[model samples]
Target: MAGIQFTDSAQTYLADLLSKQNTDGIGIRVFITQPGTPYAETCIAYCKPGEEKEDDQKLQLEQILVWLDGISVPFLDDALVDYATDRMGGQLTIKAPNAKVPMVNEDSPLNERINYLLQTEINPGLASHGGDVKLVDVVEGGIAILQFGGGCQGCGMVDVTLKEGIEKTMIARIPEITGVRDVTDHTVKENAYY
Candidate 1:
């Protein structure tokens, strides 16, 4: 909240847009989709009264009320919302420096730490093969269960990829994880790389 900034022109433009919506309690909601990954995207959408999530941080601006997505707040640090005009017209621009940067630390939760590593390390390598993995849950005894998607789902080389690549990387980086397990039903090989 402290780091997000809205320029005067941007606020006025947004307020005008909201007013045109004609909804009594319409406002703008700011969120980052696919936060903490290369695909992270900062978005602003019209949010009518009840459209806001219960956990959202309601930030009241001078003439507009903004609901900030709680999960995306960290990634929105130092975010900027501005409006620029040219000969053609004016366009609103959003700049979020940390959107695609994984934020994690030793004190962070186990699942968060695992996901951060997956996003920052594992996913990039998997992207080359059109595949990726997601942390499903941390079961008892520190077993980090995961679900693979895309080309890795039914890839014949998934076993080697798991044991040699993913498992080794996760274990070496996160000591709390006793092991990694795949929960994906790989029987459907529609997108399998191999």
Candidate 2:
């Protein structure tokens, strides 16, 4: 899917904003906190030179540079960025379809449905602290296995995140997903954000 779609007005506004900043090789970075769920919110920031991380992805279009942090890619899939003006003033709007509940057909595969819930509904809550979760496998007996990574790997609240957040969300979004299991080894504190 296209990473992000920007309206013409949004492009112009961003370019103008960047030009005003005069920070060479710097542009806007788009990100989300609590992505793909009801509480998700998108944020934009001016990125100066050397601010971009090694693994960050850049989108250059129409004299603008849009940076996507690696950890936020999944949550931002098919997002729309726009600026609208009314009698009051200009307002920035972001339309993230996948940031909420993704459309699901009844016949969708169990694994696919669970994945959608994770990417669209569950994982966004974890993304705030640089965490993400992925589907490991779907086992027999309608068990949906998962592996928490990034900030979630060695998090102190992982159990709460899984049982209260992941499992409950999966069951609500996909009835076929009877249960969830986290197979990640959280002992390594290497990349734990908490």
Candidate 3:
């Protein structure tokens, strides 16, 4: 409601597009599809008149109605909706730098920050090896207790993967995370990749 900036040209373009559509009373909805993770997305879709919940933040432009989920409004603060033309046909883009970036703040809870980093950055990489990591707990003195699964549970290279890959990344990204301890039972060796 307060953060979205619908420029004149953008309004014109969107109005034109909407006018051409078969939408009776429906409008445009801007939303964050995946709130966190590397695949976090900011998108727009045509919404039926009844599709929008009352709590959804509705931005009533002079030419068109734009609806955003209440939760998405904060992430889209100071966002710009614009149309850009090139050699080919023009494209409408939502320029919201803060939208897709994970909410990893130093003042946030240490466990929350660590979980954000792991889900958004670390786990995606490990997933390539049929593995994943989870935060069991964050203990005193900023030590992180983690558990590994899938291919990482019993791999011989898991130690190297932890020290060189996981620890290094976590420590570098989060200065407060002084140490990471993997509590996975490597002796099981059921699904080790190597």
Candidate 4:
């Protein structure tokens, strides 16, 4: 599913933008932030030489090179990048129909399905408290080890959030998950929500 369409006009415009940067091997990196959530945003950033992540997929367009963010690939499915000229100069637009849509199924790997629920269902609720969770690993016995970040890492209510919110949501959606465990060191309180 590596089919991200970049319109000819967008290629031209992006190529021109890169050339003006006066840097060799400069390219554009495309990604969606907060993907699978209503707050998702498609972004294009100038990527200097060696700025791309190891997992980024490179696409050579007619006039430009694009580095697609690995984690954002599924959400970017059917995405369109185009440039349109109005009465004013012109505007570059990115239309990603699937950016806010979660993509996963029972056939998907356990890790993928769990992460999908975390990003789509659980994290959005946590984000309101300036926190989120990451799947550290899926150990034996269908156990999911997670690490909390941001406000959740050291929050006072982390235990409640873990059991009542995250764990409940994960187990309900993916029955194969025998249980969820938190690996976060909650003593740090630096960014705790409460």
Candidate 5:
């Protein structure tokens, strides 16, 4: 999924709005319209036993339009929704991966250097923990989506290791890497050793 990148501030705003409107068991569903549509809409409806109430459906649609007034409608088109848990509490993050207007070179010399660092320096260092990192894909704006393997699949320290270790090392070696994201889905792994 390639799209605009949302700042932490924008994500916080959207998450707060969703939390306020979330009731019953329904959470917010943020999705973009099919390509070429001018507006992206957000809908809120609870996941009921079988079906959702008509009133609730209408309310959600109305609320989304109101919500869009505050946020940019076009920018929210291609977004990623994820629940984040921190010391404070759990919150949702609406991410726009394609936010940067000017496209940067994903295959730049800097990226090659970073890839080399991950393949040679970082991967070897993680061998002790049975962890491996793979560069899944690089976005045009210098964001690298990585996948974790081996023990890192379900390791509690994966986040810390990624931030304090992997990310830190990558940033130190190459300054152009704006962000490193883990695209691993831990629940579906069938070959995890630890």
Candidate 6:
């Protein structure tokens, strides 16, 4: 959560959401994934049914603000939580403006390559046990986000697969790929292969 900042718009959105709840208490829950998850999701909730009350709402907001003051705003700064309605259904979408986007390195031709080596090369080897590999993103610092799926979700061999297998193979084949990082949040999912 270092170097995180919240834009003024994000703060405003949060405040408005609190006001609309019409509950006695409200507070936002913020948590970061452990790494290697499909997507990063955040949730905000109003006071529990039995706990609703005017004082509760005030206290909740106060607590959240206090917590925000202590943390790096920019870490959570660019996040936007919006409510939308459509034919599919009404839902909340949490968008992170500063989320890392993959970049193509210009200096090295290898860097510029958008090859799905993992999909073609790595996945086949893992498919036997219903396992899969997902490429999350290529970060600015030459780090890549990877997610494990299927049998590999909570498999004890994840680290081994990541280090000796994935990392070694990727680095050997693509010299520009400096490092691989798993940004999976294991706690959110039950029975992970790793």
Q: TM-score winner among the candidates?
A: 3
Error of 3 at 138 (Å): 2.0
lDDT values for all models: 0.90, 0.80, 0.83, 0.89, 0.56, 0.54
Worst lDDT window (10 residues) for model 3? 33-42
Clashes counted in candidate 5 amount to 12
Residue 86's C-alpha lDDT in candidate 5? 82
Clashes of each: 0, 1, 0, 0, 12, 28
lDDT of 4 at 97: 77
Question: If scored against the real structure, what TM-score would every candidate get?
Answer: 0.56, 0.54, 0.62, 0.56, 0.40, 0.39
What stretches of model 2 exceed 4 Å from their correct place? Answer: 36-38, 100-194
Q: What lDDT, from 0 to 1, does candidate 3 have?
A: 0.83
Clash number for candidate 4: 0
TM-score of 4: 0.56
Model 1 accuracy (lDDT, Cα)? 0.90
Question: Which ranges of candidate 6 are over 4 A from the true structure?
Answer: 1-115, 187-194
Q: Write model 1 residue lDDT over 1-194, tens digit each, in one string.
A: 64788999999999999999999989999999998877999999999989999879988989889999999998988999999889999999999977997788999988889988888789889999999999999999888899999999988888888889999999899998878899888888897896
Score candidate 1 by TM-score against the native: 0.56
Q: Which stretches of candidate 1 lie over 4 Å from their true place?
A: 106-194
Best-to-worst ranking by lDDT: 1, 4, 3, 2, 5, 6
Tens digits of per-residue lDDT for model 4, 1-194? 46689999999999999999999989999999998876999999999989999989999877998999998998898899999999999999999977986788899888888888887778888999999998999999988999999999888898888888888888888998888899999999887897
Q: Tell me the tens digit of each residue's lDDT in model 2 across 64-99.
A: 888887766776777899999999989889887765
lDDT of 4 at 17: 93
RMSD of 6: 13.0
Off by over 4 Å in 5: 1-108, 188-194
